[model samples]
Target: MNDNIKSFLSVLALVAVGASATLWWHDMMELRWESRRTMSEAARKDRMLAATRLLQQNGRVVNSVGSLGELIVPKVGGGTMILSGASGTALPGQAEEMLDWVRRGNTLIAEPRSLTSAEKAALAALDPSSEENDDEIEDEEEEVEEPKPAAAPASAQGKDEDKPKDDEDEEEDEEEDHTPPEPPARSYFTAVASDNKDPLTDRFGARVRRDAKACECRTEPAEEDKDKPEAIAAARRERDKTVSRLILPGKSYPLELDGGKMELVGLPNAVAPLWSDDDGGAVRVYREGKGQVVLVTNDYFSNYMLDERDHAQLLLALTELTPGRHVTIVRNLNVLPWYKALWRNYSLFLISLAGGVALMFWAAVRRFGPIIPAPKAERRSLLEHIDASGAWLWKADGGRQVLLEAAREDTLALIRRRAPALFRLPETQLWATLARDCSLPKADVSEALQQDAASHVTRFTRQIRTLQELRNHYER
Candidate 1:
């Protein structure tokens, strides 16, 4: 092969082998855990499909389980909802479509973390602000409210005894009346996104701060009530509820519904506060044409949280928000990740890979290898090797043995070619059949075929040549 082509082929082979190894390793890891869980399987607690079953029983879920663009194209109708958990990270191309779906009145319940830049931009446009215009309008409105004249000082107001306060008392009264306003409470949240002028964030008043590490929350029974028997029985009943025995991630906080009313079931978290004291995370509802956009800081109503606290109640409430609600839960994967595809059908992938490598090898060798002229014959004549070996054997005193073996092989070959059925007979019967077929005397035929019995090379050669002549004459 040519150097360049050979080098390319070598590199290609190395890359294919490396890629195959990587896919094998990934497949092993996937098998090490479990098969990828579908949304319908309820037993997959780790992957959280329990919530899917709950939704299936309660609501009308759409068949929008593919890419995001599929659902957004027709602009999902109002009263229909799209549900997503933390796994529903939108692919890059899906951003615009998702924005349209939400803006067109479809409810999208997703983690703030999954919002793409395009989706965020669409969110920001939901409630566009005019800070400069608002400021100018406020400045214009304030000009009409002129301050009323202050009361006259005590010295000038001798006629009114009730207004006879000293200058020191008047200053003290002004100080008490004009209490300084409390500064705006510090935001315990960081922007879910990096947009400084993000209108959606401003409207919501807060978003989940990504910097806060997730804390594990284990639910335990509340303390017993000793004073009242009724209270103690109630406490015991409350402690036996399913929510008290589960372990859940505390990163999800309750969303306060103001513009929209919130529906929840089950008792509130009685343990230490799960969220920062200052970070009463925000929720905002924006009206877009006939539809509304409800944004929340966290996707707490998900499968992972369904069994913990009121998450199942929260999800049920979402679907039951309006009767006849159609909900579509978007379980997202990457936009056709190649490795995932390969791992999914590894046998086919391996076969294709091997075929490709073989083709590449063939092409490389064909293009790059030196060309040689074709030989005269495909195979040398049969007698050439026999003659060569026979000469050596004769010099080594094994010529008679070679002659005997050759004579026997020649006789078997002739009998196999003609009167083939007789070849399977005993030696004596085969000899008689051969003699009868060749129209020769039995004694002469026997003497000719037994030429191998001669011990000397001269006798053997003479007998072999005689038998050959006799066979040639009989065949003619």
Candidate 2:
């Protein structure tokens, strides 16, 4: 082949390879774009963020407070307050205050707090069986006490019959008056959908209900079923089926509620059922004074569940009932951070504390008068040097003997200067001469001159003192 033909073939091959690479890159990009589109965005931290936004979108002023304590009630035209994670039993005093606020023409939407152990025990004590037994006994006694009447004259018989009838009516009235009042109904959340028709549910064109089963389903298996795998599997299957989806008119949504059941007893004012479950009423309403209180059995307005079924619709309908356009949602109760609470409730105290600390730091760093000159550095005194040297020598091993020998040598040298003849004498004679010259005892002079180890501080101190005196005497 010619050179031009070969070059043209090479150029054509390069073009083909470039097109293939470009197509491959475009395919990978498309796959990545599809995957990214399928992935969900990051979840919000606040559980009620969606609900809050929903209220705002409906032209209502929504405010989210941390706790019930921080909730600010309007002075006029009371508005609606939604207690998301709060309950009446959690804070009795605060709950009562909120109720009083409600009585002044406001609406409070809250769930009831879970019953305590003592409360549960008290409820258990009021058993229906016991009440039924008492009623049966009373009925038997009344039957046994029936009395037969004797025949009387026509004129007196009529009056007698009318009098007995009057007496019987009065007795019946007394018995009715003496009867004990019925206990309040205990309501719980259930997986079964609510079939009741109410204003809240009617707004969404469907009934609202929690899909999860009652909390009691989470308990351990019974003793009889402990060893049976089949029994356990059946129980698990039962629990798994508790979750249900809400079938609306056109669409269905999963119910994702997270709350326990609550007892509706001992609540102030008369409670009217709004929604019912298999066990009891799941939602109730009552009036305090001019306003009303709506007690929900579960948290259906949480962030995760707000968009499910008719939860958001239900919330909107509730807020619309209030006189004003403002809505407050209390997310928690008594959950403020310590520092934030201190700053909010005790700002004066915190300000005073900060001022005091700042003053102390200023006093420490700032000069009270004109800047003072730095103290002049000076050499240590001769006595200080001597004391330091002596301390070091005393701490050394066999230091006491060395100290005595040095002192003795100095004394002997001084004596030699005073009397050179003393050096020729023997050690004992020199000690006696030194003792006489220094006016010290002969034994002390001899002990001080000897190279004996000092057993303790007292002996060492005495020997040092004697030698010092002899050296001074010889110098004199």
Candidate 3:
């Protein structure tokens, strides 16, 4: 190909590469935007964060805690506290303690199930008329009771005597008998406007209205109703139809509220109803000592519901009831994992423990000095074998005699090799000649050459030494 053709091909290749890079950059930007949107949605899972922020924005010092134990009670001029996400039941002995805290001039706002037996007792103490009414009913019942004998005589003629004597009495009896039986008690309650004045509800001139019977209030279906599809459909319809609204004098705003199903019953006369419904009170406030307790059955201040209607306004109103600037919100009673709690509370201790463990492990596995090369193998000397053999023979039975005989033979062989003329001589002459040649005593030479075994250790050792000396002198 010519230079022009090559240049044209190179330009086309560069253009293709640039177009591909542009497309890839656009796709990457799209993916980054999509991922950020997903993360933003996931970050909003906390249902109370919005409420906390609202309180902070309104100049209130807000603190969030998981349980009541973490609550910090103010020393003087007590603060307001909102307790949520807990069943109304108090742990053993917690009710009395909590009530005592409330009596110290703190305002407590919580659900119905959060109320303890001690609090109920305090409410009952506030209303003595209920007990009086019960007593009067008992007295009337006792007065209507008659003797058994008198009642039996009346029953004998009751068939005809039971008839009313006058039309007015008959109409009265019919009215009494035909009165519709009181509706069965329900487990749930709704929110409605109360006739009584309240500082919390008076600001907005509005109240949250909810359905009397909605599926959201019932956590589970009844055993008999579970099998009925019609019952299920009706409950779903009611749930769908349930539309809560903040109703003012002329205008109203749509609201969505999540509330507990527990009914607030046995309220004292001293409790000022902020909002109520046909079944029971939805919100109430009462005084104990210098403190006030505000009961809220519905959780309308949640993150999802805070911006709806006037829910946030109601929260601000509740906060205004207290003089203190601090507001503590107990969102849940969940216990944190041990590790997370340790890290949160005793971070220094956990860090120190981790550092100590790491140091210990390092110390255990650390090398102290340079590596030493392995020693080279060496052959044993002849003297070492002889010493080892002597040790083994010394430990054996009759080994001393055998050693003496071996030494005598070895001495004679040395003499014969060095001086064969001395061996040809008679025994006594040979010994004298060997002694003269060796420069050792004649008696030592004869004893060394003798075949007799030494009895004691001292004698045996001496004979072996003499034999070794004669052999050494002749070898030299």
RMSD of each: 30.7, 27.4, 22.7
Sort order, TM-score high to low: 2, 3, 1
- TM of each candidate vs. truth: 0.31, 0.41, 0.37
The superposed Cα distance between candidate 3 and the true structure at residue 18, in angstroms, equals 46
lDDT of 3 at 318: 71
Ranking by lDDT: 2, 3, 1
Residue-level error in angstroms, candidate 2, position 428: 99
lDDT scores in order: 0.49, 0.62, 0.60
Measured on C-alpha atoms, candidate 3 has an lDDT of 0.60
Highest-scoring model, TM-score: 2
lDDT of 2 at 14: 99
Write the residue-wise lDDT of candidate 2 on 63-85 in tens digits: 78777667544432358988875
How far out, in Å, is residue 399 in model 1?
Answer: 59
Runs in model 2 lying further than 4 Å from the true structure: 1-43, 73-77, 88-93, 128-280, 357-365, 368-476
Q: What tens-digit string does per-residue lDDT give for candidate 1 at 1-476?
A: 78999999999999999999999989776555546844545444323356566777775564445434334445454554544432234544454455565565555454343233444344345534422333343354354343566989877676556554696588678988897854432221222233233332232232332211111111223465465777667644544331211122233554222111111111122122222212233233344434444444444545554555455765565555344466665554324456655654486878889999999998888667577878777676889988887778766666666766677677667656755687579878767776776676776567666534466666666667656754574456
